[model samples]
Target: MTSAPLEPFAVTIDFATGALVPDPDVLDRRLADLDGYFVADIDDPGVGAYTVHEVRVPPTGNNLLSSTTVLAPGKVGDEYFFTKGHFHAIRDRAEIYLTLSGEGLLVMALEDGRTVTKEMRPGIANYVPGHWAHRSVNTGTTPLVFYAVYIGDAGYDYATIAERGFPVIVVEGEEGPEVRPNPRYVAS
Candidate 1:
């Protein structure tokens, strides 16, 4: 027996609100959810950090997966709010992020401890190559919104990132957001 074919559908992105019309399930991350991901402890861990809405799809074949991440602007000890970075479980699966509103940075790191950062702003699309662990940091005073697309089977390997940490971090500086080496990084 064979399964039915997947149907194509359309979804609208409300750029101003950073919402997906028709409403996809949202994953909310509070500071509490990011325990060791930051450099300092927050007085209120229950404070909202970021939210993610992903269009669910089968994790197979060439089907593309799409998601929207809206990172709230704030910080803990000068370190900006950020997503918990991850490498694709498949290792060779690449992804692209298109900034819709606000400003931020796309920080990517290689296993060799090398790192690079891409400025994220409206109209800019950053390509994250395979094997790079990537994270997004909200550097502006408003929510940083972006849409990401990647292969369906490009499962996330957050454990490696949680265990080893990224080589660099984004922090608020007198000149604005700055990228600095993470003293706690453990090369994998």
Candidate 2:
């Protein structure tokens, strides 16, 4: 199967409702469920609350040029499925998340214990600065999906978050999922 430069591709509906909403058995990337995540609530670690399908590029010296990540929707107990947030290993490298469809929030935290949350919707772009740790949640009934572009060399450092999780976690709100301080964490 010889391919050409800038080959046109398509995005299919792979998942929704926390299930593997496969794309009619088409497309070429492997659908994988992320492993080893930190559950905000220790008692109920609802595994596989969400899934991810990504198109990753190989290393190109300094960094990979671009990549795409599509996250499926689900939840752990009352909390929504969210990306295990992280700060870039390189520290100075920032990232952008452009919402392609659905709805949710881009929750961020400053090192000084301050936190911020922004709504995500189609046609909106969230600029994540270097110092904050960022994560995305699926607040909509449908699969909350988005496309992301980031530096190739900017690897993910999930340990800092793994050890000292995010300051707040989004849980089922009466109106929708709302942000609440993580009880497991004691601010110091």
Across 3-105, the per-residue lDDT of candidate 2 in tens digits comes to: 3445445444332222223333212211123233434333434334443444444433344344334545666567777777788887767788877777899
* lDDT score, candidate 1, position 180: 91
CA lDDT of 75 in candidate 2?
Answer: 64
lDDT of candidates 1 onward, in order:
0.90, 0.65
Candidate 2, position 156, lDDT: 76
Point out where model 2 deviates above 4 Å: 1-47, 58-65, 186-188
lDDT of 1 at 179: 92
lDDT digits (tens) for residues 5-27 of candidate 1:
78988778878667997666799
Task: Report how far residue 140 has shifted in candidate 2, in Å.
Answer: 1.0
